[model samples]
Target chain A: MNEQEHIDKLMLELRRGTITIGVLSQLSSPQYGYSLVTLLDEKGIHVEPGTLYPLLRRLEKQGLLDSSWDTNEARPRKYYVLSETGKSVYEQLCVEWQSIVSSLNDLILNKGDDVNGDG
Target chain B: MEMVNRYVYAVTQRLPQSQREDIAIELRGLIEDMLEERVGDGGNNTDKMVEEVLMELGSPRTMAHKYRGSKSYLIGPELYESFILVLKIVLISVGITLVGAFAIKTVINPVEILDHFIEFIVSTVTAIPQALGWVTLGFALGEYYGGFKAGDLKLDKNWMPSMLPPIPHPKKTIKRSEPIIAIVFYVILMGMFGFSSNYFGIFRFSDGEFVGVIPFLNEAKFPEYMPFLLLLLALFIVKECLKLISGKWTMKLVVCTTVVNLVALMVVYFMITSQSFWNPHFMEGLMNAGIVEQGTEGYEIMETIWKNVTGATVIIFIVALLWDIVDGMIKVRKK
Candidate 1:
């Protein structure tokens, strides 16, 4: 693969872990799939619908999110909110992510292999 | 514009039926809002502009995955890995249990038993395609009926063809029995194979032990069990009637009838055990009803015929039980 393709592949792996964090953070209040996508996009995360929908479903299945159907409208919509477990995990992930970033930053500045490192 | 509609559907389809419509509505609004921004005072083709908006959004599966946030195990596309994992585990476990049960039943013929085992495995593997067809049909029918009745597939007029393709509402939702039929077919299949072979006999409790009192037509100690045949026909009629009627009465009828049948069987077994009417002379008295045995060979042939008939009856009853179970599963899945 070309250097650009390699970079893109690595970027995807990094983005996947971050995307779950991003989704959980947004679900403080109940939001449907599209609304969440729009909110994420407006914030410059630019997540695709494919990646978001399945992740939300997985999270819900894992007991991290609570979902309910809204039948009051002509077209019923399912709204999702972060569960109690999800809030705690998201908070922990945030703390871990910050520490990792700081540690990586220090390594990049001190180490000679900074050019090849993306983190 | 058409492409955009497809894109919107892709993302929304993953959502629960209740949420899919609102997500579609919101997506259409987003696209329209974007189109308006791009075409401000410009008389360019609105169709081309909408198509561009969709291209920027990405493919339908991708969009759906985004809206879905994460793949929920429920109502998501079938996962081959997970499916294979489950199928392998279940099939292997069933195979092991069946082998163990068969080994305990017979001691003489190892080669014959192995031959039967190989045949069973081949038959079971070949049957999976059929199983999948029935399972998918049952699930789809349940979903369509369940969601449609709940008003989860509605569309708004503002969401035009450009934003969303108008899918025809499914007319005449499948009744609950449709998926049940698929389940019934599988149960009948399993029961047929189970009882005939020693491979985990359907009603058999342990080695050489039959759970129910089965009529042995081949044995000269007892005459033909005409009353048992009549009872089977009655059960068939009752099953058919349950299919026709759909209410509290149908379920009540099934439960009450099943209980009545069980009680009648128990009574018959008790009577037979109380009176030793299984003597050779008593059976000879039954021979007086019709044509007497022409020869010993004739008696042997008659015995084989009766044995086959009894086997067929047992299979039929098993099929009915399977049908009931599959029907129940369909109902539960929909709920």
Candidate 2:
């Protein structure tokens, strides 16, 4: 009900859709579940292991990601990478995302301009 | 290590069988990786560190919910509002029917009225849970089979502007009171005619003392008309339910109501014409009470009027039904 809690909810909604794009962008190379978490964390996306692992499995089910077990490691790990279909899909998504970002920036900037009495 | 395995088991058990094994293995590996990052690869990872890693991941159920993103429900959000609306209408009508039935029974034999009141309360208590259970079961099936969203069946089709229903004017909206009052009215009629038609008669009194009653309906014929009357009641209640659910004058609803009313009209015609429907002794009772002479014009006129009374009411009812059907069709067709 307070302003901060309200803002946090809106921010969560904004991140929910774009998180898939972020995950897809990083799966060009095979990355294990833990490795992907650390990678995204280092890049400041901050996804949980619980959240990322399920997302990886769902994307694989949709044929947008491929997975294999790397049992050769000390601890058996499942590594996920982009599939043939995934690559094209991610490319198209990136194009759409760029257009969305530009349009949203324009809408926000124009509102600011109108408030400031400048075009 | 023990805590980590328990956590992994908790999350994987909720997933599908095939998924359980894979998710269990992946969750364990992820836990180990987190533990290693906290304590150096070979630096003794204490219980505290393992607990911290598990805590960061959240409860097992929250983790499972995230992994299984699909939502589940007995009555989902889409149909929940309509389900509750129907439940309220059904419960109130059933309660009224019980109350009316008990009241009529008390009047018939003139037994202890308090006992009838108690029985009415008890029946309403039992009827409510049965109503709730049936409505919940119905809505659950509606949700489970995914029939509620027919649009999902044609997911590949492009939506056109013309496919949208036109917004109804305020007057075109089916007021909640309309169908609710209609349902209550029909149930009261059913309770009266179905159970205690013979009891509907004239009561004589002298010196403010209790006196016997003269019945109007042929008691023997009441059972014969039960099925036909029940059919009419069912059709009318169901039509009102549909109207209540739709909440507006859509073409589909208008057509459906029209069809149901026409069927009820047929049943109403047969009801008034049956020879045994009205009591043949009604005129004799009136005359024996010294209200009229045996062959007076008043007696003959009263007899004639009583014979055609049910028919007149039936005619009026048919006309009302016809008017409702026509009015619905016209409202729906309006721009």
Candidate 3:
């Protein structure tokens, strides 16, 4: 593939990997599927409705999120929040993410220095 | 509103009955929220806004597939690699066998070579779809019974990197192609033995017309032992299939292989010793063809030669079977 397509594909995978953590971060307070989509979009994460809705269902099925329906509204909406287990898992994941970012930054910086040294 | 309902219907129809109602209600809420955001409080352009939102959301089938979390594939990823390996082995062996059969046919009847070539091509083309259909069916059944749940194809709660099977030593690991090729070979051999015993005979040609045919085994008696032969063939096929799925030598496989070989050897020994196994007219056909003279030294020599050949065949078969059993046991021991 051309450069743009290759980079786009890689970015898609990168974004997909982080989407779980991003969703978990948002679910601290109960949020309906559409509200969560809009919240993430405002943060420039830009998740699709189809993707976000399914992910919410899957997270709930895994007991990482607890969902309840609010029938008191104009239309019933399912609102999801983090479960107790989900909170602990999210905390662990944040620590893992920080370490990964630090290591990756070091590796990239060293590679850049090596390139300049060779030149 | 109608368009919204239709879109919701499209997505919900693909989901399970229990999930459809809940997902539909949630989808409707999401759609209305999207429309409200797009069209500010005015309801005048709602239909157009609904269409636009649905378009941005992508096709309902794609959304349904996402929500259902599994695409309906006839042969799923779990068995797909093994299926392709088995298909390749079957197709390649079948092609080679068909070519070999064509060559034999041409050698036996040079003048009718064109007819044989056409028949071979037709047979090969038909055999492909037949083999593929059966392989696909077998794998589909395997996938169904193998406890593969929808949306659970990848590693989930019960999976861990540490749970990965230990890498087998090169000698202990079975090549993916080995069992596949063996299964194909046994299938074809069984078909030939069960259906076309007459085709194994000696053919004589004279004056551009087929002359005497000395049949190897009595065709009439074949059906009497067909049930037993079929049972053995089924057992052999099962053994090969198990090997292909396991992809490594285990104690179970070793025991199975030993049992199948032993039973096959016993069957072969019994058949060879039975009077009905050989055609009664074979000697007479040889005499009629003038290959041997009646009540002469030539006839006695021919009889003695036939006896020795059958004896040698039995010995060779027994030895080969023993070798296979021993080899399997050794491999298992190494593992």
Top candidate (TM-score): 3
Q: For candidate 2, lDDT tens digit of each residue in A7-67?
A: 9999989988888899999999999988888888899998877788889988999999999
Ranked by lDDT from best down, the candidates are: 3, 2, 1
DockQ of each: 0.17, 0.78, 0.70
DockQ of 1: 0.17
TM-scores of the models, in the given order?
0.38, 0.73, 0.78
What DockQ score does model 3 reach against the true complex? 0.70
Q: Which stretches of candidate 2 lie over 4 Å from their true place?
A: A2-4, A69-77, A99-119, B1-22, B32-50, B98-121, B150-176, B187-228, B241-258, B269-317, B325-335
lDDT of 1: 0.57
Cα lDDT tens digits, model 3, A83-109, are 999999999999999999999998887
Q: How well does candidate 2 score on lDDT at residue A90?
A: 99
Q: Which ten residues in a row are the worst by lDDT in model 3 chain B?
A: B147-156
Each candidate: what lDDT?
0.57, 0.83, 0.83
State the lDDT of candidate 1 residue by residue for B224-284, as single tens digits.
Answer: 4334434543454444335333322233444644554455455445434433323323224
- TM-score: which is higher, 2 or 3? 3
